[model samples]
Target chain A: MISVSMTVNGKAVSAKIDPRTLLVQFLRENLLLTGTHVGCDTSQCGACVVHVDGKAIKSCTTLAATCDGASVVTIEGLAHDGVLHPMQEAFRENHGLQCGFCTPGMIMSAIDIVNRKGHDLDEHTIREELEGNICRCTGYHNIVKSVAAGAHAMAGSK
Target chain B: MYAFAYQRPTTVRQVQSALGKHEDAKILAGGQTLLPTMKQRLASPSAVIDLGHVAGLSGIEKKGRNIVIGAMARHAEVATSEVVREAIPALAALAGGIGDPAVRNRGTIGGSVANNDPSADYPAALLALGATIVTNKRKIAADDFFQGMFTTALEEGEIITKVSFPVPAKAAYVKFPNPASRYAMVGVFVSKKGSDVKVAVTGASNEGVFRAAGLEAALKGKFNPKAVEGVAVDGSNFIADIHGSADYRANLVSVMTKRAVTKALGK
Candidate 1:
């Protein structure tokens, strides 16, 4: 077992885990941060996506030990002071989800896209950037809208 | 994933020591490909060496006429780097199109090239640009670097430090990606440096990524898509998966080459 420590949603957390423990398994099992889903553990489905140092990544394929000193943000960390993050709000307003299994990862990935690509995201760019994320429901029409609204709202929130 | 000893070594020498200490060890650069394979139980190393803490292993900058990228530099860094964008927009675009936003954040150029997945994007760029693979042991040309599918000339314990890509006068990579997995089905990278031209194909060959001598000969000095229009590409050696037939991939090699040449010419 390896002792790993990381700041999760602004809280310092540490755990003794198996050397091969994935970050998604660590987050969901060890810390009980079930907000991060594991739709497909093969890294194909982005249901386990989260922010590591403010960038979106597939937690299922990453080792928990590799994030020893990193800061991780999950869907649970999106809201602050009883207020939802703009992206979450936009998802609600735009109905970006259906079965909701892909919401957390979708929202996390959307916010990171806004962080990097900025607020003026076009439909084509959002669709292209969303290639890694798989949404089995909604056919991505609403998700595209949510990302656009979220990008614009995020720009204002910041 | 099976049990293994995890070690995060901060230096090249430490990594060497870790490898020397464990006979069955695997180096983890970006974990893009390795982790997936591990999760599937296709790879089970006794020791998984993490190179994340290694110094001077992740960055992008211009060194002389080449763009020097640290091996550990993430795909996002290369995709969004101003230096890479300015030096070779084709390379930047190529990086930007790999996997997706999340995958790009974690995947690294060194990992991609080292793994040499048949469908990977970087090998085509490396081959066409004549990039130099800089390892802890020595600097090797791209021509001598790739041996075959999922194989490289890198000896055991030889860690890739950085890669230096000579700025091409113009280049572009065009691929028909598998819609779901995003792995290239048949991709072509076309580049020209002075009077010499190089064209490399990925995702279509059974022998893995390879240079297209016929297309290269056609576009040598002309640097035009029309130059390769008449060239014949054989289909027998191309990969024939469910995504495409060998003939179709061979056809894509020609189609993608033409498109790549047109993009390289900025048309």
Candidate 2:
């Protein structure tokens, strides 16, 4: 077993995990942070998206040991003191999800996109950026709206 | 995923030593492709060496007339690097268009080149720009690096440290992305180095990314989109898959090649 230590959701966390353990598995199984869902075992599904050192990455494809000493932020990190994050609020307000399996990752990825690209995102850019996250339901009409709204809200705050 | 010993080395020497110590070791660059393959039981290494912590393996630098890119640099990093954007804007756009935000953040150019997937985007750029693959052992020219479909000239245990691309006078990449997976169903890279013009096609050929000699010869005479108007590429060696037929992909090579030239010319 490899001993790994990293900051998760702004808190320092450590665990003794197998070298083969994926970051998603470590988050869900070891830390019980099941908010970061795993829809597909392949990297195609962004259901396991998280922020590693402030950049969005597919946790399913990231090894837990590779993130040793880095900072990670998952879906569980989005909420604060019973208030939903702006992206989460935007998703809820815009009806971005139907089944919600891809919500956590979608929100995480959208937040990261806003953090990087800011509020000038267009519908086409949102669609292209969200290609990594697959949603079987919704056909992406409302998801795009959610991202745009989130971007607007983010921009309004700054 | 099978159990393996994992080590994160912080320096190049330590990375090389770790690689030298383990016979059944795999260098983990971005883990975008390798981890997925491991999850599917396609590749089972006894030891996985993580190169993310290696300090010098993740930057973009301009040396003389070449753009030196660290192998471990993520697609997002390359896409956003001012040096890459200024020197090779098309490369930055290509990197920015790969996969999505998550994949771009995690996938490294080194891992993509090492894996050498037939449908990847980077090989087309490297081939067209006449990039040099710098490894721990020696530097291999892009022309001689890619051997065949999903194959490269990299010897076992030889790790790629960096890639240096010559500053092209003009360049662009055009790709028809797979709808679901977002990988290139067919992609073309067109570049002009001095007076010589090079055109490379990826994701459409069974032999992987290769120079389109017909297109090259045509463009050499006239470096414009109209140069490829009547060119016909032989589909005999093109890759035929569910996304497109060999003939269709062959036809797309011309179409994408034309579009790439137009884009490179900023038309």
Candidate 3:
């Protein structure tokens, strides 16, 4: 087992984990942060999306060992007190999900898209940027709506 | 994934030492490809040496006439780098189009070239842009580096440190991606430097990424899409699969090349 230490969702964490343990496994098993889902462990589905050093990436494929000194943020890290994050609220308001299995990943990825593309996102850009996150529910029409609203909400909040 | 010892090295010298010590070691650049293979039990390396922490391995800068990218620079980084955008916008566009947003956030250009997947986009860019692969051992030109499918001139224990690409006058990459996997079904990269022109095709060849001499010769002086019109490429060497037949891919090669040259001209 390799000893690993890093900041997760504003918490400093250090644990003895198998050297081959994936970042998603560490988050779900070691820390019990299950919001980051693992729909396809092969990196095809973005159900394990999370922020490492402020950039969203697939956690299923990233080794926890390689992220020793980095700052990581997951779905659980997004909300403050009892209020949902703007993106999460936007999803709820816009009916962005049906099954809700891929919501955490979608919310995380949506935040990154907003961060990179800013609040003036178009439908086509939102559709193109969502190539990573796959939702079998809602046919992506409402998800795109949620992202656009969320981008505006995020801008308003700031 | 099988149990393995993990080694994180901070320097190129340390990478060499770790490789020398571990008999069956695999260098991990970005886990986008390697980790997935390991999860499926396809690769069972005894030791995994991560080059993430290695110094002097991740950045994009313009050096003289070439755009030099550190080996560990992520696709997202290259896609967004101002230097790459200014020096070679097509390269930035190519990097932006690889995989998805999350995969692009982690996948490195060096890893893509090292794996040399027949469907990868970088090899087409490397070959067409005339890139020089810089390793801890020595520099190998792109022409001498790619040997065959999933193969390269890299000896065991060698680590790619950087890649330097000559900034072409204009270039563009046109890729027809496999819908589900997003790996290129056929990718064409066309570039022109002065009067010299190059056309490279990836993902369609059974032999791996290769230059299309027929298309290059036609576009040498004219450097236009019309020059590539009605060009017949031999489809016998193309890999025929359910996604596309050899003839289909051969036809796509011409179409993509023509589109790329037209796009290059626009740039």
Candidate 4:
């Protein structure tokens, strides 16, 4: 076992985990942050997307030991004092989900898109940037709309 | 993933020492490929050496007439780097088109180049640009670095430190990507520097990324889209997979090369 320390959801967390433990496994099993789902253990699926040191990366493929001393943010960290983040609010309002298995990852990846591409996202830009995240339900029309709305809302909130 | 010892080395010397100590150790660059393979139990090294903590292994800078990219520099970094964009916009564009945003955030150029995946974009760029792969032991030209699919000239215990790419007067890359995986079905990279012209083809060849000498000769004679029209592509040696037949890939090689030449002309 190796000692791993990282700031997760704005809280510093430390644990001794197996060297092979993936970040997704660490989050769900050790920390119990199950909002970050694992739709596909392979990196192809974006259900394990998370923010690491301000950049978005697939947690399913990242070893927890490699993320030592890093700052990680998951879907659970988006809200504050029972108020949903603008992106979350947009998803809820715009019906960006159906079965909700991939919602956490979609929301996490959407915020990353906004952070990288800015608040004014077009249809083409949103679709292109969302290549990583997979949505089996809702046909992505509503998710695309939610991302654009969330981007604008985030800008407005700031 | 099999149980293994993990070591995060802060210096290249330390990495070398660790590799020497563990015979079956694998150097972890970005974990974009290594981690996934491990998850499926495809690779089970005795030890995994993490290069993330290495101080001088990640950066992008212009050196003399070439762009020197550190081995650990992520695809996203190369894509967004202003220096890379200004020096070689085609390279930055290629970096941007690799995988997706999330994958780019963690995938490093060194990892991709060292792995030498037949469908990877960097090999074509490196071959077309005549880049040099710098390892701790020695510097190897791109032509001599890549051996075959999933093979490189890097010796055991050797680690890639950086890659230096000479800027070309004109360059472009065009890829016919597999829709689901986004890996190139047939990718062509074309470049013209002074009197020299290079055309590198990837993803279609079973021999791995190779220079299309016929296309290069045609483009050298006349640097135009029309020059590639008469160049014949033989599919006998190409890869035939479920994604595409060898003949289909051969045709795509021709079409992508033409498009690449046109794009290089900025038309």
Candidate 5:
């Protein structure tokens, strides 16, 4: 077992974990931060998307030990003072989810897109940027709309 | 993933020591491919050496006439790097189109080039640009570095430190990507350095990424899309899978080469 420490959602956390432990497994099982989903265990699915050191990466394929000393933010970290993040509110307002399994990852990835591409995201940009994310429900049409709205909302909130 | 001993080494010497200490040890650089392969149990090494803590192995700078990128430099960095964008915009654009934003954030140029996945985009860029692969032991030319499919000339325990790409006078890459995986089905990278012209093809070859001598000859004669339109590519040596047939890939090679030439010419 290896001792790993990292800041999760702004709190410092440390644990002794197996070398084989993935970041998603560490987040969901160890810390019980199940807000990050594992829709596809492979790296192709974006359901395991989370911010590590200010960039979005797939947690399922990321080893917890590799993330030592890094800062990770998940869907749980999006809200502040019991108020939903603008992106989260935009998803709810836009009806961006159906089964909701892919919601957390979608919202996280959307925020990442905003952070990189800015808040004025277009449909083509959102759709193109979401290539890593796979929505099995085939609800990409609404997902695109939510990301656009969320991008603008995030800008406004800032 | 199998149970293994993990070590985070901060220096090249430490990494070499770790490799020497453990049998069947694997160097982990970015985990974009290694972790997924391990999870599938396709690769189960006894020791996994993580290079995240390694210093002096992550940066991009213009050294002389070449762009030197550290082995640990992530794809996102290469794509967004002003130096890379200004020096060889084709390289930066190729980096930008790799995988996706999340994958780019974690994937590294060294990892991609070292792994030499046939469908990967960088190998084509390296081959066409005549990039140099700088290892801890020696520097290998791109032509000599890539051996075959998922194969490279890198010796065991010899880690890649950086890749140096000579800026081409004109260059562009055009890929016909597989719809599902976004991997290049038939990608062509075309470049011109003075009177010499190089055309590298990826994804469609059975032997992995390779230089297209016929297309190169055609381009050398006339650096235009029309020059490659007349050259016929053989499909027997190409990969034939459900994604595309050998004949279909052959056609794509022709079309992609033409398109790549046009893009390189900025037409």
Candidate 6:
């Protein structure tokens, strides 16, 4: 077993995990942080999306040990003191989910995009960028709207 | 994923030693492709050496007339690097237009080139730009590097340290991506080095990335979009898959090639 240590949601966390254990498995199984979903293990689905050192990555494809001493932010970390992040609020307000299995990853990826691209996103660019995050529900119309709204909200604060 | 010993080496010498120590070891650069294969039980290495902690293997450097990119450099880094942008704008555009933001941040050039997935984008850029693959053992030209589908000239335990690409006078990449997977269904990279021109096509050929001699020859005669208008390549050498038929990919090769040339010419 490989001993791994990293900061998760601004908290230092450590675990002795198998070398083959994926970051998603470590988060869900070892750390008990299950807000990050695992839709497809093939890295095609962004259901396991999370921030590793402030950059979005597919947790299913990242090894737990590889993230040693790095910072990771997941869906569970998005809420602060009962206050939902603007992206989460927008997702909820816009009804950006159906099955909700892909919500966590979608929101994570959306927040990263907004953090990078900001509120100036167009419909086609959003569609193209969100290709990694698959949502079999809502047909992505509302998801796109939610991302736009969230970006607008964030831009206003900035 | 089978149980294996994992080690994160912090230096190149340590990486080389670890590789030499482990008999069936796999160097883990970006896990975008390898981990997925392992999850499917397709690859079960006895040891997985993580190169993430290797300090010097993750940056972009400009040396003389060449852009020396670390093998472990992520796509996003390359996409946004000032050196890459100034030296080869098309390369930055190609990197920026890879899978997605997340994949761009995680997938590394070494991982992509080492994996050599037929539909990958970096191989096309490397081949067309006449890049050299630097390994721990030796340097191999892009022409002789890619052996076959999901295969490379890298020997067992051979780790790719970096790739050096010549600064092209002008270059561009055009790809018709598979809508679902975001991998290139047929991608073309057109590059002009001095007076010589090279066109490399990926994601369409059965033997992986190969130069389009007809297009290259045409562009060599006249480095303009109009020069490649009447050139034709045998479409019999492309791979057919669920996303596109052989003929469809063949047709896309020509179209994408033309678009790439046009884009390179800024027309």
The C-alpha local distance difference test score for the whole of candidate 2 amounts to 0.91
The alpha-carbon deviation from the true structure for residue B183 of candidate 1, after best TM-score superposition, in angstroms, is: 0.7
Candidate 4 DockQ category?
Answer: high
Which portions of model 6 miss their true places by more than 4 Å? Answer: none
TM-score of predicted chain B versus true chain B for each candidate: 0.98, 0.96, 0.98, 0.99, 0.99, 0.96
Whose lDDT is higher: candidate 5's or candidate 6's? 5
Q: Write the per-residue lDDT of candidate 4 for residues B27-50, one digit (tens) a residue.
A: 999999999898888999999999
Task: Indicate the residue-level lDDT of A23 in model 2.
Answer: 92
DockQ of 6: 0.86
Among the numbered candidates, top DockQ falls to 3
Q: What share of the true interface contacts does each candidate keep?
A: 0.98, 0.98, 0.95, 0.88, 0.93, 0.93
List the candidate 2 regions with Cα displacement exceeding 4 Å.
Answer: none
Q: What stretches of model 3 exceed 4 Å from their correct place?
A: none
Tell me which of candidates 3 and 6 scores higher on DockQ. Answer: 3
What would the per-residue lDDT of candidate 6 be over residues B98-133, giving only the tens digit for each residue?
887898899999999999999899999999999999
Q: Give the per-residue lDDT of model 2 (tens digit) for A1-158.
A: 98999999999999898888889999999999999998987888899999999989999988888899899999999889998888999999999999999999999999988988788899988987887888999999999999999999888765
TM-score of each: 0.98, 0.97, 0.99, 0.99, 0.99, 0.96
In lDDT terms, how accurate is model 4?
0.94
What digit string (tens of lDDT, one per residue) describes model 4 on residues A1-158?
99999999999999999999999999999999999989888887799999999888999989999999999999999999999999999999999999988888889889999999999999999999989989898889999999999999999999
Clashes of each: 0, 0, 0, 0, 0, 0
Interface RMSD of 2: 0.8
lDDT string, candidate 5, A1-158, tens digits: 99999999999999999999999999999999998999889988899999999999999989999999999999999999999999899888888888888888888889999989998988999999998888878469888998999888888887
List, residue by residue over B1-267, the lDDT tens digit for candidate 5.
889999999999899999999999999998899998999999999999998998878999999999999999999999999999999999999999999899999999999999999889999999999999998999999999999999999987899999999999999999999988889999999999999999999999889999999999999999999998879898898999988899999999999999988898888
Model 1, B240: alpha-carbon shift in Å?
1.0
